[model samples]
Target: MEEEYTLDDPTLLLQAASDFGHHPGVHSDASAKAFLHRFPLPVIINGCKNREVAKGFFMVRGWGKQKGSFSEVGCCVQTEDNRGFGFGEYFLEESRSSREMVMEETGKEFGFWEDLWWGDQPLGTQYPRLFRVVVDKNISISSVLGPSRPFSWNLNFRRNLSDSEIEDLEGLMRSLDDLYLSPSVPDARLWPLSSSGLFSVKSFFLALSQSSGSPQNFPSKFVWNSQVPFKVKSFVWLVAHKKVNTNDMLQVRRPYKALSPDICILCMKHGESADHLFLHCSLTIGLWHRLFQLAKMDWVPPRSIYDMMSIKFKGFDNSKRGIVLWQVANIALIRVVWWERNARIFEDKARNSEFLWDSIVFLASLWAFCSKAFKGIPLNVIQLDWIAVCTP
Candidate 1:
């Protein structure tokens, strides 16, 4: 006997507007204004308000602005299109988490003195605790210094400074004596990833992608073939990276499941891997041989999909169009084999190697017809003599 019960709706897992509206840290007009108040340099520099400051001096946000009046400086003041000074949208999308942004701002404040060093020797490393006294009191260099030279220090420490602390502070003052604080130009945060030092979403994304330990030997040219359909190209990319859900991949993905017979479905001899399934299997070999025969070329099969995609086939006589046709055929063969394997497993259907070769030629011909080079040419002519039509 089995119990009969209806499963809870899957949509119940998703949050509703009423529920998400109450979630903390949700970006809103008021919250965006608050965030901008914490970092006001962007707001002021973008024609929001006029303020007097030293040229090339970093303007810390909330310096003289009243509390809770971020809008006064046009921080989150919305335009007619509801885009508030552009900072609100940037804060919501481009900027990191609020906590991270706050920590970055705090670090910049504490490390302000280090940036003033114009000498070859690192001042911050030599006198790390030079600004520690003022940092403890949440004091900024701008707050302490007088408007005119000789600048006066108004640092207030939590407790009486020790002899070593006093020595470090004196050294810091001597270091700052030669540094000039500009009175007109506001210090802007430069993006280090790009040459222009301007923040861009593309640069940020590229930085993240590079930092994520991506494979060095990615088959970019092979996987991104413009002749094939986007879906086929994506499938080829997965196969090239050995990320396709072959039997071995299935085993890894569902480790707890009792998936047995992890062998190449096409040959049923060796273990199923991206290399074996698409490149080394007997059925796959036959398809490759057929492709090579149709192209009227002598070739040796590569070890893996990556190797296959990486190698440039010779005998094309430096013909760019011929190379493109060869590439399209290779990609189509891979797609056709995978399709047949899936059909056999899921639909209990099978196709012979010759039939699969025909399918590959048909698929490749269809993609070729889509190209301007093959336009106005009959489909049967292209399919029958792909190499002849593409050759110079």
Candidate 2:
């Protein structure tokens, strides 16, 4: 393999797509260009020029290394820029309906304007300027327009002029008359770098990404699987990815350790951490026991949230559906435990283990019944089954 590759190189890009888990035969020239266009040009050009630096930067941001794995790096860039690859634009139908529904309720302009320029229009104030131009009346004008000060300065004053000086100024303004008091409307055809008609490389890439309308990142089967409620799945994703601010995490991140409580709010026996609060705390252990009994399985809680989420119930009742139930139950336990911990700390209230377990049972049943994964299963049936399993 070459040490570097460019977007212009289709074969290498196709290989990169394959490395990113895109099927080999599915990638065509058009598709590859579509994918490559989703990234900033520097991300393509400069990244191709310096492979190690690009790879290192991406790895530090939680992306896995692959030959063509810059897709995720592009996602990180999009996230940092707060300009998703038109996820908002791609779902226009959904957004339009939502926007219309809100309009129906409020009966006013219901959406924000993206390009609204605040304050005065500056239309009349806009004008072209001429500055220290050494023009010789004797010679033909080489170029009348040169670097200039603001038009305000041009209008304000002029020195006592020789007849030739008056002629020169008149010639200069008359030569460039079309530019005087021109409305500075934004150009729609070109990138908004300057009036020089050049591409703003950054804006060009951003516009390219928006025009392609590809997803900011690949679909995550792990997060979007049918086993859990959408809200529960989102919560687990945040926890497993270490995105939430727990006491332990806050202490490590911030210089002031005094800001975060040192002890676990649930147990008050050990330092608080996501793993400890959700999985290992004595208060959470009893809840876990009830969860295991509900599944009728023996499970040693994993040391981390990631592993706990990936745990599959292997008891006698372990069917595909049964596995989903336990997984949903496990994630629900995390959510409830976290909620209870916050309640104790913030609200000065707490629930007992039995109450927590009952919440989990109701939550798990509701999620399963409502989700497409368990569409064939009735709500009452799921509720009864949840109760029967946990009744030991």
Candidate 3:
């Protein structure tokens, strides 16, 4: 005898149908009948078999109501039978009914004249209530023309208009004379943030980020240096943005933890901060002075890491290979300073100013050698005479 299977198990039903080359031979339950009725053989076969099923089972069942005309808020989808109202007329009627319902429910009237007016000039100082009352909310804009020629507003107010309101109404009509309506095209919402006028999450996020204030300039040249390692670049970027986990940042991030004597590890006289440690500390100043003296260039101290990275070198040519060495040297100095700071805090180890400056020169020479611009150059040559290597 053949194995018994119920229609409730769709897998077995499909298997039986495939075996018998027809409908499955199984007892139907209420759920199975409802499922079969809701989704016919064509739908099930098309969904499961990718329309590769035999043509014998591709039957269509028509038992429900047919859609005559489908209408959305801004656009319309019509069927073969266009035996209904146009989209404009339907939208106007629905808008008027919704306005009336809102007014009745909340005792407040809402106006959309700002949305409708697409003129080149502004509709200044006109009352929204006057626009709502004067214009027929149930009619299209093309139907608002006067009996006379030359395009006038044939307004019909529900309430008596005062002299001031009449003057404002006349100004509004003058503004509307420049407006033209295209009834054939469907309405569409455009995103002003993007060039293609399509909505995107990136554009929306940028808009929200800039809404509070002007966006700060990013130090791309400093943070995206190809000569430096990725972790060193990331650390420099954090220092530039004041996001490094110094004692001052820790105070704000963890207020409950008692971090005593929040002073700079490099210069214990001042409090520790991203700016203080990287730019203003006495030890950091000494290191910068040493690098400048080695380069034989006079420089003014910058107030912050961002200012230091953003400032352009006045006398140097940017396209020359020497500029690459200079940039790598600057980035390496920042990384070495951060390393020294962490060493003092975490390892209880310290390096004097002379040792730190030597480390900076060594690391800068090593990183500069790895760059394609400085490839095949002797490492000792770069370490001994870096100023010559950085000269155009």
Candidate 4:
């Protein structure tokens, strides 16, 4: 990608979009003579030949990238400088709407109108800028007359949340099914000694993760499956990817260290990367097969957890199937894996595929019941599921 421009260029900055036309349609001609009508020759090029002339014009005060526009806000002006006086304005007036203008002015907090030199009613003038407002999901903008384009930012909560709003944020977390787990979660104190990640409830949700908008990052592809809701995607990414403190830094809480990091809690032979716990561990693989049979889905053993989630299974759509069965599968898998890990470390419980099998099945049934009962898919579903996951 071209680097984002940090410094400004004088010539390009000086070029206004308002002036490049001759008698009338001349600016449309693209010939050197057309440009000379609006700007002095010296302003463009010292040795003004036709070939060099157009090139020179691009560097002039009102000619280049900032091609003049008559637009007040809505209609688009051609990059070509100088259209008829009313053309771009007519388009703007026709296209612009007051509501859009208001949204841009208020919602995004932008625009420059520090000084107004002069104005006339007939000329009909105002500072042009992108007016954006976040209304539900729709945003509106009014590009005012001239070269500039209007832009708006949709703030999640205006600059800062009010006390009432802050209450709502806290209430939202408490009332809704939990969406995150982190080492620092306040609820960590609630965990029994048997739980492996005995961090606060907040810490469990704050794992380092790729930022939400990264197109290539895994979080981007995390489909809003029936298993997972869109409202909670951000929460999931934080825990799973540990991109808290906004994707640049890792782990919001301290990194989770198993009592012993080297040995797999399930097999006690393998190491614990995501892959080992989710797939290569023999106990986990068996849990996968049994769950697949229970869900009545095809079973292709994943060599790794990433491989498992990465596969394109047939017929996965949310609205239609709510294959909540699929989401249940993921929930069940993660829970079982963590359960097995805790069992080994805290309970000194050894690996038992049979135990893993029974644990996931029972847990899936419990969550499926909760989901159906209007519990609103628990957020700390992992931790909540942990209650039912025994070390044995």
Best by lDDT: 1
The global Cα lDDT (0 to 1) of model 2 is: 0.50
Q: Is candidate 1 or candidate 3 better by TM-score?
A: 1
TM-score, prediction 2: 0.44
lDDT of 1 by residue, 246-362 (tens): 888888889898667777789989998999988899999988887777666898987778899888776333566676677788898899889988998889898899899888888
Candidates in order have lDDT scores of 0.58, 0.50, 0.56, 0.38
Evaluate residue 155 in candidate 4 and report its C-alpha lDDT on the 0 to 100 scale.
26
Worst 10 residues of 2 by lDDT: 98-107
Better of 3 and 4 by TM-score: 3
How close to the true structure is residue 112 of candidate 2, measured as C-alpha lDDT?
14
Model 4: runs farther than 4 Å from truth? 1-261, 295-304, 315-322, 372-392
Instruction: Please write out the lDDT profile of model 4 over residues 1-392, one tens digit for every residue.
Output: 22222224223422322243333565532322233224322122122233334434444422333222221221112222322111122211222221112112221111222111122111112312111111222221112222132222232333465565556545433432322222221110111211431222233223222334332334234334435444444444443543323111322243563233556656657655566666667777767666566444687675645455556553223332234445555656666676567666779867567766666655655555455432454444533443232111
TM-score against truth, every candidate: 0.55, 0.44, 0.52, 0.33
Model 4 whole-model lDDT (C-alpha atoms): 0.38
Residue ranges of candidate 3 with Cα displaced over 4 Å: 1-190, 201-216, 314-319
Better of 1 and 2 by lDDT: 1
- Per-residue lDDT tens digits for candidate 3, residues 57-92, read 322211111111111211222222321111122222
Q: Tell me the spans in candidate 1 whose CA falls farther than 4 Å from its real position.
A: 1-191, 195-198, 205-212, 315-317
